[model samples]
Target: MKQIILYAIFVIFFTWNPAFGFLSGPIAGRTGAPDDICGTKSCNDPPVCHGSYNINSGPASFFITAPSSYVLGETIDVTVSFSNTGSGLHGFQLTALDASNKRVGIFQSKDNTVQTEAYLNEYAAHTTVGTARTSWTVQWTAPLANVTYPVIFYAAGNQADGEGTPEDDYIYNTAAVIIQPTSTPTPAVTDGECDAETIQLSQNLLELQKGESREIVITVKEENDCVAGGVSIKATIKKGKKRISLFPESGTTDEIGQIAFTITAKKKTGKATVVFNADGIKSKLKVTITSK
Candidate 1:
C-alpha cells in the first residue's frame, strides 16, 4: 500500500502543469548546456526538458549582423535577432567567442526581455508576463579592437508551445557570424585640396569608472584606416575637467597620424567633452564618467 502511494505521487509530479511549475515559462539560463549553445551540438528533437506541442519542420531562425571588418580599438555595434513560426513562447541564447573561445567586449540589452551573462553570453526569453511578438533584438559592443583573426558569434533559439511538454515543441535553431579585422588602409586623395586631413578620436564614447585612468587614441584618417600624415592635433577638456585631467593636451600626430593621450578622472562627472582640434576643424568625444 505504501509503495502504491509513492508511485501515485511520482505520477503527479511529472503531470503537474508547467505554466505554474518551477520552469513555468522560458527561464533564460535554466536550459541545460551542450544544448543551450546549440551551434555545434544537436538539441534533443522532442526537447527532454521543455515540452513539445506541434512537430514543425521549419526551424526557428537566428540572425546576426555586424560590420565585415572593424578598425582596431574601435567600438562598434553588433545586432542579433531571432524569430520562429508564430509561437507565443520563445527563448534564445547568444554569445561571441574568439579563436580560443574567450568572451569579448560588453553587451547591453536594448529591450527589457534581454539580459547579458558572464563569458560574453546573452539571453532573452518570454517573461512570466509573456509576449505575443515572436521576435527579439539585442545590441553588442565589439571588443576593444585589434582582434587579428575573427570573432565568431553563435546563437540558439527555441520555438516553444507554451504548453510545457517536451514532446511537441521545437527546441533547436542555430546561427553564427564572423567579423574580421580591418585591413591596412591605402592613402586616398586629399579632401578637396586640403594640405592635410583632419583628426578625430577613434571612439566617440569614452566610458570610465570614477578615479580611473584610460588612454585615448586620436587618429587622422582621410578614408578609413589610411592615416593622414603630418597632421597636428590638440585636445582640450571643454567642460568638467576639474575632476578629470588630460596629459599632453597639444601634440602632433606620428607617422600614422595619430596621437595617444591619458585621461584620469578623480570623481564622477556626468559628461565631459574632449575636443580634438585639427586643421582648424574641431571634433569631440564625450566622456561619460560613472561612480561604479
Candidate 2:
C-alpha cells in the first residue's frame, strides 16, 4: 500500500510542522512585539500592531491587574491574563512604559514560556512543554523617588486555532493599566500645657549669653508625693518671639520624674519667660539673653 504510506507520512509531517500544517499561534515576539514594533508602521507593511487585525471578533480578552496608585521606589505585583472565547491557543505581549515610552522598573516571571524582550516588553505564548493556559503573573518595581508622572502598562493578546496561519486568527485584544502617584501626608504639629497637681521645676530662672544654650529640668509627682514618671510636660516661650529657641519644647518625665529641655538665646539682648505645664500644673522660667 504505497499510496497509504504516502498519505500517512504527509499527515505526520503536517501535524508536527506547524509552519506547514495545523499549527497556528505565536513564536515568541512574532505577532505583537509591544509598543516598539507593533505600534510602529515601519515594523510591518500594513502594521499588524495591536488592534490592527480585529476582523474576526471573539469573546477573548487581554487584561492586566495592578495597583491603581503606586508608591515611589516600591515593588508591586502585576498580573496579565489572556482568556479566549474558544479552546484556541493564546499568546500575549506586555510592557510598562513612562511618558517617554521607556521601560519602568523590573519584570520577573515564574513561567518559562514568558520572557522579557527588548529590555522593556514581556512575551508569553503556548509552548510545547506548557499548555495554553490563560493567566500569567509578573513582578514590577516602581521607579525611584524622583519619578513624578504616572506609568502605563500596555498589553496585546492573540487567539489562534492552531492552524499555523492568521487566516482564522484573532489579531489582538488590548489592555492597559495607569498607575498614579501616591499622595504624601503632612506631619502634625502639637503644642503643650502644665499640670499643677503634681509637677515642679528644677530651675525658676535661666541665664544665658546671646549665643549660649542651657538645660532646664522639671520634676513631676503624684498627689501622695510619688514620682510621676511618664507625665506629659510642655514648655512654651510665652513672652519671647525671636529672643530664644527651645529644643524639644515638649516631652514626658523620665523614671525619676525629671524632664529636661535645652533653651538657647537667639537675640543679643532680651528678656523672655518659658512656661512648663502638665495636667493643669504650671511653672515659669525667666530667661535673660545677653551678649557674650
Candidate 3:
C-alpha cells in the first residue's frame, strides 16, 4: 500500500512540474492564442490547463525590443527580456506577423537556449525549460517583397520559480510594431534631363542659438542646368548627431528640383556638419550652435 501511494505522488509531482513535464511540443504562435496555456494543443485549440493556475494580473514583465523601421530584405536584431530577476527558469515564444495576422519574417538565433519551432519556422521558443535565462535575442529577416502594412512582433515569456510546480509562476505577453521604409517615387527621364550632376544647398552655413531651428533648401540639376525632379536625396549628420536634429532626412526632389530640411539645435553648443546626397551628387553644410 505504501508503494502505491509513493508511485501516485511521483506521478503527480512530475505531471505538474513545468521543468520536467508540460509543454512537450512546439509552442509557436501560442503567445497570442485564445488559450493562455502552452503546449497542450495547437494555437487554435481550447484551454486545457484551466484548473492548474490562474494567469497573473499584474503589469507585464516581458518586453520586446526591435527597430522602429525595417528595410525590405534586411535582417534586424530583436530581443526579448524578462523583468523578473528572481525567477530561476525562463521560457518564451515569439513570432512576427503582418497587419493581416499572417507570419511575415524568418527568425534565426545562435543561442542554444532558444530554437525555432519545428512546426512553424517563424516561431522561436525556448529550447528547454530547464535553462535559466532572462533574455534571448534573435535575428529576423524581413520579407523580400514590400509589405505595405506594419510588422508586429509578439512575444510571451514564462517566469518560473523552479519550485517543481506551476504555482507562483507568471506568464507575460507583449508586442512591438516595426514600420516599412517609405517608398521613393521614380523619376521621369527625358533625354539627359534626369542626369543629376550637382547638388546645391540654399545655405552653406547656419548659425543658431540653443533650441533654435532653421530651414535650408536643396536643389538638384543636370549638366545642362536642367532641373532634375524626382531625384532621391538623403541627408546624414557627419558629426554631432546628438547636438543637432535634421528633419526630413531623406526625400525626393519636387517638380522644381528642390527639397527642404529643418535643422534644430539642441542644448549643446557645438558645430555639426550635414552631408547631402542626391543621386550620387554630394554637398555639405556647416552648422554652429551657440548658447542663448
What ranking of all candidate models by lDDT puts the best one first?
3, 2, 1
Report how far off residue 191 is in candidate 3 (Å). 28
Question: Could you tell me the C-alpha RMSD of candidate 3 in Å?
Answer: 17.7
Using TM-score, give the best candidate's number.
Answer: 3
Q: For model 1, what is the C-alpha lDDT against the true structure? A: 0.49
Q: Which 10 consecutive positions of candidate 1 have the poorest summed lDDT?
A: 1-10
Off by over 4 Å in 1: 1-47, 50-56, 72-77, 82-84, 117-131, 145-148, 183-292
lDDT of 2 at 222: 59
In order of appearance, the predictions have TM-scores of 0.43, 0.45, 0.49
Give the alpha carbon lDDT tens digit for every residue of 77-137 in model 2: 7776766467446655555655344557666655665555433434333333322666667
Each prediction's total of clashing residue pairs, residues at least 3 apart in sequence or on different chains, is: 11, 14, 0
Compared with the true structure, what per-residue lDDT tens digits does model 3 show for residues 1-292?
Answer: 0000000000111124554464432334456422223322322211322223223233346678888777777888898888746756677777776644457878886567667747356877766542466788878988987443446676666666566654555555555656544343334557655767888664455555678665666767776656688789999999989789989889997765767788888999888999999867799878777664
For residue 203, what is the lDDT in candidate 3?
Answer: 43
Could you list the CA RMSD of all candidates, in the order they appear? Answer: 18.8, 27.2, 17.7
Give the CA lDDT, 0 to 100, for residue 277 in model 1: 86
What is candidate 3's local distance difference test score?
0.61
